[model samples]
Target: MAKVTLTNMCMIYDKENNKVLVQDRIKSWKGISFPGGHVEDGESLIDSTIREVKEETGLTVSNLESCGVIYWFNNETGEKYFVFQYRTEEFSGELLHKTDEGSNFWVDLEELSNLHFAEGMDERLSMFLEKEYSEGFGSWNQHQPGKLQFQ
Candidate 1:
């Protein structure tokens, strides 16, 4: 049997302002990325995403649109990691300036390319920004980095 880990990430879009909320991470996987974290046992994927957003950004989000999923298979350990991706425009509550994870702020979607992104985030961003792709899959070993393909 393979070991599997489940996680989630959400894009909080302020459509009227043409900006998306991003976190400048201070922990592992540092750099700019959306708010997210590991799923708790017995928690639904959507719930986990919502909870993570609230914890990391201090905002409650709803009407989440399922953007897609990204997963990778580890050749050496036979471990698989999955990240559920979501985008939502409906949210409430005051945004937090910073958390133990990082600082939260809005950035123009067009400016994403100019900002430094967390590992593989640029590829992951495609799942949220482009409607054409729904899934991203990749394979890697302990010694090599994985390459993802969107589908």
Candidate 2:
């Protein structure tokens, strides 16, 4: 049987300045991306998103909007990865300088391309930012960047 995994990303957007909260993950995962984590057993996707944002960035977010989803599969290993995308400009908290997951900071949305990110992450972020609704189906390969069909 194939394994299925669920993850989420919560982007805190500042519409006024076109800036967003991003993190540089220096722990188990290494990259500059939004705060998020895997959905726990029996947890709803939305709850997971909120929990992850709080846990990773110390922010309590509300009024979250679902931006999209990503479906990645590795046929050879029969593993599937689903990443739920979310964004919210409504949140309240004193931003923490660092968390176990990484350092959180604000970056201009326009400058995201100039920052380093995990494989395929920049494209994923751009997809969320540019499109109102989007989805992706892809092959997930460990040794290489997988091919994704976007819509």
Candidate 3:
């Protein structure tokens, strides 16, 4: 039998400054990435995204726009992981500088590429920034990295 895990991530855009809020993770999947986490049982995807953002970033996000989904399948473990993506410009509350996850800060869009990003995260940005792609998928075994492609 195969197992499937669901997660959600949000790109909180500051349209006025051309910046996006990011987290420098110190735990699993360490590196600069968006604020997000696993979806709880019985929680809707949108709600999970909203909850995770607040938990991780100290912000209440609204007016969310569904970006798309990114998923990966591990051939060796027979597990599939899905990340439901979202973006929003509307948010409230004081942003936290750090959390149990990592440090949170806003980075200019142009400077994002220069920062150290979590594995596959650099490629994942297309789902939020590009209007054409709706999905990203990858398949791999335990010993190797998966090749991700957007569609």
Candidate 4:
């Protein structure tokens, strides 16, 4: 019997270029990711992104819109987790590299697929940056067939 964890994420857009910014994680993980992280026990999704981004990049997140939900399960421990994805086209403050999450930088649309990324990275990305303005939330879930329901 395991448990699930919830994380919040934010895709911050460049103020001048209007392109979304992504960075490489320093301490661990695959390649590059957005400027957000896990939500705290008492924190809201919006608050979590704002705080996480600031802590990771020192940029104040403003005008964030919820994009989607992501669900995953640990292969080893059977732990499930969910993530809330957000989009912010506007922001203030300077970017600061705070922790081992790596050096923060912005990437253009053409450069997104070129970056070394974790598995399933391109899936959500293509949707987020998709043209035609089809804006909304999404759900990506990985449920184990034999595993008992957590509920």
Best by TM-score: 1
Per-residue error for 95 in candidate 1, Å, reads 0.6
What is the TM-score of candidate 3?
A: 0.95
Each candidate structure's TM-score, on Cα atoms with residue i matched to residue i, is 0.96, 0.91, 0.95, 0.77
Would you list the C-alpha lDDT of every candidate in the order shown?
0.93, 0.86, 0.92, 0.70
Better of 1 and 2 by TM-score: 1
Q: What local lDDT does model 4 show for residue 57?
A: 83
The digit string of per-residue lDDT tens for model 1 on 1-151 reads 9999999999999999999999999998899999999999999999999999999999999999998989999989999999999999999999999999999999998997788999899877777988679999999996899999989
lDDT of 2 at 80: 93
After superposition on all C-alphas, the RMSD of every candidate to the true structure, in Å, is 1.0, 1.6, 1.0, 5.6
Write the residue-wise lDDT of candidate 3 on 1-151 in tens digits: 8989999999999999999999999998999899999999999999999999999999999989999999899989989999999999999999999889999999999998898999889888878887568899999986888998889
- Per-residue C-alpha lDDT of model 2 across residues 1-151, encoded as one tens digit per residue: 8899999998899888888999999985588988899999999999999999989888899998888898999967989999999889899888886998889999998897899996668778756687634898898567866877788
Q: What ranges in model 3 sit over 4 Å off?
A: none
Q: Write the per-residue lDDT of candidate 4 for residues 19-110, one digit (tens) a residue.
A: 76786776655577786778898888889888888898888888888766666666667677777778888788877754678888887766
Worst 10 residues of 2 by lDDT: 124-133
Ranking of predictions according to lDDT: 1, 3, 2, 4
Distance (Å) between predicted and true CA of 45, model 4? 1.0
**Shift of residue 133 alpha carbon in model 2, Å:** 5.4
Q: Lowest lDDT 10-mer window, candidate 3?
A: 124-133
Q: Deviation in angstroms for 116 in model 4?
A: 1.1
lDDT of 2 at 55: 90
